[model samples]
Target chain A: SQTIHQWPATLVQPVGSPLSLECTVEGTSNPNLYWYRQAAGRGLQLLFYSVGIGQISSEVPQNLSASRPQDRQFILSSKKLLLSDSGFYLCATSTGTGGGQTEAFFGQGTRLTVV
Target chain B: AQSVTQLDSQVPVFEEAPVELRCNYSSSVSVYLFWYVQYPNQGLQLLLKYLSGSTLVESINGFEAEFNKSQTSFHLRKPSVHISDTAEYFCAVSDDGGFKTIFGAGTRLFVKA
Candidate 1:
């Protein structure tokens, strides 16, 4: 059972400010970590995924970037935030097994408000 | 590439009544289908999934979804609904290797008393 811990349940930042959202996983090692953004009244959008440390793949290009500093630590960063960056960001992890992914466990998410 | 479509944006159902949330997908390769539930102000939770074998899958909380390969759909259903069932349901699809998973727009299930 993997548990995802995300910090700062809610954040209010000004435009052009830097942003960093951290996510750490417990109960699993070398898991596949992902960053997803859900805009209000929209679906989950895959932002980035990392298979291992220092290995990240971006799904969509935006003002955000992701990094896997450690096996269980995933970080989403933005050099300069924009108003459109304001949304609910989620950190999720899943174990790859039998050529398929097991259930994905999600964090409580961070509601980012860029003013 | 794979994409998922949740037909309804919101579904209003009465307590103790049957409810179904429709989902359809398009993919070039074999995929793993999943249904995730998101409560208000909370993250999404995996409800159930269909990888292989039986097309139908059941969740612990009395929710079930059938994987219809022919129709390319995975619709979630429950015989009787409760207020606790109110949440946003999302349909997801991933490749066989489970690399990238895409989620649908989400269907908000509102259970009325």
Candidate 2:
């Protein structure tokens, strides 16, 4: 079974502090990984997506960046945490074969609270 | 570019009542549609998807969605809902061969007793 594991399930960071959230996938190789930030009423915002090692795609200009150093490891980071950066962060993985991508499998998510 | 729009923001229904959540999408290329359910404080889970072939797809949990290409819509329906069904539902769309998947604003379904 494919599984996504994200760490720091909940975090309380002070403004201007640095941030790092890690996610790892098991039971699958070369899967597409994504980072999403969900704010109240705004739905899941696609922050970044990575299809392979050292490749990252930023969906929107924001205070965050993503990196895929390994095939199954994806990380979300920020140099400085802004108050507006507080939200639930989710990590998901999906496998694609010839035609299209499959449904995503998500981690428990990290709830970041920038104080 | 592709985008998704879930027509309803919230829907309140009693247990065992039928419900339909509307979704519409826009894409310049052939697309794939999906519905995901997120329980409170939990990550989202895939409920169903429409890739090709049949326009209608059903989940193991009795939820069904029909993809209407002409209307650019994929509406989810269930004959009856239970209290356990209360959750936020998101409609998503992605272009064929694209890695970026866009999600709708979401519809919160409140199944009351």
Candidate 3:
């Protein structure tokens, strides 16, 4: 069975500090990876998605960026955190093929608080 | 481009009562629809999906959804909901062409005992 791991499970960052969140999937190769953020009482917002190594698509223009450094390793980074960046960040993976039909599996999200 | 709309932001029901959460999508091409449930402070879990056949799909937890092509809707329903079923439910849609999935704002299901 495939599983996704994300860390740190909870993060507290001061304003203007750097941010790095890592996601790694075991038991799967070449999977589609995605980064999403959910504000309190709001819908999940797509931040970025990667199809392959070194390939990433940004959905919203913001203070965050994503990278696929390896086939199953994805990272979300920010040079400087903003107060608006406080939210729950989720990393998810889906089977790569047959577009949109395969269900996405999610990791335990990181609750990020930018103070 | 594809989009999803979950009609209710919150649905409150008593435990063991029937419940229905409505969802609708808009897309030009063929699409796949899904319902995901998120427990408090946990990641989203796939409840059910409607891809091609039968127009109806069911989850192991007694939740089911029917895909209506003409109505462009996929509504999730459960005959009797439990207090454990109290969670946030999301409706999402993706095109058959491998595009990214777009999720609705989500509906919070509050099942009171």
Candidate 4:
């Protein structure tokens, strides 16, 4: 069975502070990893997705960035957090088949609040 | 550009009542459609998907969606809904050849007792 782990489960940070959210997938190798943000009443917004290590595709221009250091490890980072950055962050993985038919599995998610 | 539109922002239903959430997509090429459910303050979970072969697909939780190629719609429905089924439902589409999945604004299913 494949599982995804994300942390810290909840976070409170001051504005203009640096932020790093980690996610890792187990029981799968070379899977497609993604970073998403969920705002209150808004739909899931794609932040970044990586098909392999050192390869990332950003869906929107924003204050956040993502990196794939390993096949199963993806990190979302921000140099300085903004008030708009506060939201529920999610890490997801899908089979690397590239057909878009495979289901995407999600982690429990991290609640980040910027004050 | 390929896009998905969830017709209703919220659907309120009494427990054990039937419900339907509409979705439509626009894509010039072949499309793969999916429905995902998100509990309050949680990540979205895959409810069902439509690739090929069968136009109708079902999930273990009694939710079903039928892919309508001609109409460019993939509407999710359930014969009866429970209070546990209250959640946000999202419709998404991926070009059969593309890796990125575009999501709709989402519909909130509020099941009342």
- DockQ of candidates 1 onward, in order? 0.64, 0.62, 0.70, 0.63
Instruction: Choose the strongest candidate by DockQ.
Output: 3
Candidate 3 lDDT over residue span A28-58, tens digit each: 8888899999886678988999889999999
Q: What are the per-residue Cα lDDT tens digits for candidate 3 across B1-113?
A: 78888999999999999999999999999998999999988899999988788998999999999999999999999999999999999999888887487889999999999
Stretches > 4 Å off in candidate 1: none
Q: Candidate 2 chain B: worst 10 consecutive residues by lDDT?
A: B93-102
Ranking by lDDT: 2, 1, 3, 4
Write model 1 residue lDDT over B1-113, tens digit each, in one string.
78899999999999999999999999878888999999988999999999889998999999999999899999999999999999999999887866778899999999999
How far off is each candidate at the interface, as Cα RMSD in Å? 1.7, 1.7, 1.5, 1.7
DockQ of 1: 0.64
Q: Which parts of model 2 are misplaced by more than 4 Å?
A: A97-99
Residue A101 Cα positional deviation in candidate 1, in Å, after optimal superposition:
1.6
* Over 4 Å off, model 4: none
Candidate 3 scores an iRMS of 1.5
Residue-level error in angstroms, candidate 3, position B41: 0.9
Between candidates 2 and 3, the one scoring higher on DockQ is: 3
Name the weakest run of 10 consecutive residues (lDDT summed) in model 3 chain A.
A94-103
lDDT of 1 at B20: 97
Q: For candidate 4, give the lDDT of residue B13.
A: 99
RMSD to native, candidate 1: 1.1
| Selected candidate, larger lDDT, 1 vs 3 | 1
Task: Answer with 1 or 4, whichever has the higher lDDT.
Answer: 1
Question: Could you give candidate 2's per-residue lDDT for residues A1-115 as a string of tens digits?
Answer: 8988999999999999999999999999998999999999999999999888998989899899999999999999999999999999999987675345668889999999999
Give the Å error, residue A22, model 3.
0.3
